[model samples]
Target chain A: MVRWEPGAEGRLQAAALNLYAERGFEQTTTADIAQSVGLTERTFFRYFADKREVLFAGQEHFEQVFLDGVAAAPAGASALDVVASALEAASAYFPDERRQHSRVRYAVISANPGLQERELLKMATLADAMARALQERGVDEAHAVLAAETGTTVFTVSYRRWMAEGEERSLAAVQADTLADLRALVLAAG
Target chain B: MVRWEPGAEGRLQAAALNLYAERGFEQTTTADIAQSVGLTERTFFRYFADKREVLFAGQEHFEQVFLDGVAAAPAGASALDVVASALEAASAYFPDERRQHSRVRYAVISANPGLQERELLKMATLADAMARALQERGVDEAHAVLAAETGTTVFTVSYRRWMAEGEERSLAAVQADTLADLRALVLAAG
Candidate 1:
């Protein structure tokens, strides 16, 4: 017989998200989150460094997915194409079931400057990681950084559209539209 | 008899930047900045909303230059072209004499997460203004936004490159290279 141990981290995160959505991020406490998840406050602290860390727990996973996607891009692709393909792969990792909660969390984070800064830092770190991955794929440093920045820009636009529209379209579609828009903008400028 | 008036805001910003560069953003205080400018603390407050505002006082002027340049772009020019033209015009606004101080200020701001967030907000606002200007010139809203974002991306890349090499190249040349790189990335991707 297999034993079913408590998924303390997942439960704490789910509880924190719910509480944050119901009340607010600033209003919620680690104790409240711990109690809701039926875990001790100590256990909660053991899982997350702080209450805010619960909201950002998936950042590491996001980085890994993006890096792996970039690594797997075709060898002949240009830096931009490689990045776009990686973003497409990363998009598949975000599901519709989680979109509502993600939007709510984003709203909470956006309303707070500190949280917004943390989010930006996280995104910047991700951009750096993508650039490094591109460099490993044989792209030069400057072009690799530009490619990563371009990918981040497209992701930002697509995510904004997705969140604003309640995730009605697939993430891939939104990303594709963003890439096309980028191309058209450049060609028009020329 | 004649009366003399001082540019209080400019003096305060200069003082603040000097302190920030010599010491650091975290080590500097409003009082030190005020004293260095030969003004009372109250006078500094009257000129700026806070210490951070001193560093950002000129952002509006930059935005205006960019918008004006975009508006004056030749007819039938693409959105990217308009944005590139705006960046070129804006580049002329940055004084050669202030390059060293500007570099120091940039380093301080980049090193501080709080300042970085504020900087991002400012850039986002400028991009929004650029998009609005483009829309006023008959471009569609979505396309205008994409164009503005692309332009900002190029400007950022060019500015970073210029800073990276200690301002050896003219801002105009760097801006041109950035636009060319962006266009090439997009075309290669397509």
Candidate 2:
């Protein structure tokens, strides 16, 4: 029995991150998060399945950004090009405004193996979504899956580089560079 | 305290897998594994940190195989080629004799998100180990990591294909074919 509360979701998420950062993920509980947000436990449950869910609220939205990008890519684009375009579209989801929060989120995830596993599962699920999106665009099943996985790898490497100290380039710029590096590596492999 | 009983480790692993197969991983317990092996719970703990660890007993040995192959690759080999060679060496770890076990192991892993997370962590660790091994062999840090990761992708795709019903190709052969497919896909992308 949960009721809608305007702005409650964002407030709860911010509170959860703060508590997780302050007390570590394992030490943080649902009640603590709800209390910090001035909300009830039932209200928290309305927005998130659990504490971990708060950290991953954007997984589905990010997946949609990626898939929409693939669908809107120029016809006849190479498979990698389509994936790259999808990445480009998805990059907007992590603008400079969110950089500090992203860093804190990444830090919390890295500090907890449970969170890291959840991150892995999210990435794996996104890869599958990307693959299916590619298949919808007429690519073969095997090639679609590979390209999607490779695209996820590209996103991961670029995200790390983008988060590194003194990094000033946009996420899109870093992604383009890493994609080129991957291309060159693959080419040289043959 | 743990005792060094000859054949105890193998017996425990076999028993754990059997139990996991018969009564799902979630339903199976460490005590059940020990009881089936005619050993005390203390002995099971001595062999495995937990029930999930039993499914991952070969992770370290597999990592060693990859690292050893990287160390032995020719000095002039390209980064991807070096990783391919490592995969070739590691292929021996999953010969036909182990196919049934591997299939059962993968099944148990697929059934549990917790196990899937552990599997992802193990794979990530192995990739890092492979990357470090390549760096030691004179490959640049960036190229080493990318090559190692790509090789892991190749291994994963090939292993899945090999495990499919009626697949008769050897692990090494499937790996060779998959590597070639990746090369072609990347070449086409560029």
Model 1 chain B scores worst on lDDT over the 10 consecutive residues at B1-10
Clashing pairs in 1: A188-B78, A189-B81
Question: Which one is best on TM-score?
Answer: 2
Question: Model 2, chain A: how large is the TM-score?
Answer: 0.96
**Which stretches of candidate 1 lie above 4 Å from their native place?**
A1-6, A24-53, B1-5
Tens-place lDDT digits, model 2, residues A1-190: 5567889999999999999999999999999999987889988988899999999997878899998889888889888889988999989988978778888899999999889988988888888899998888899977887888888888887887788778888899988888778778877774
Q: Go through the candidates in order and give each one's C-alpha lDDT.
A: 0.81, 0.85
lDDT of 2 by residue, B34-147 (tens): 998789999888878998888888787889998888877788888888898888888888899889888888888888989988888887788889889888888887677777
Model 2 lDDT at residue A131:
90
Candidate 1 lDDT over A33-145, as tens digits, reads: 98886767888878789987887897888988888788787888899988987898888887667678778889888777667767777877788899899998899987888
Write down the worst ten-residue block by lDDT for model 2 chain A: A181-190
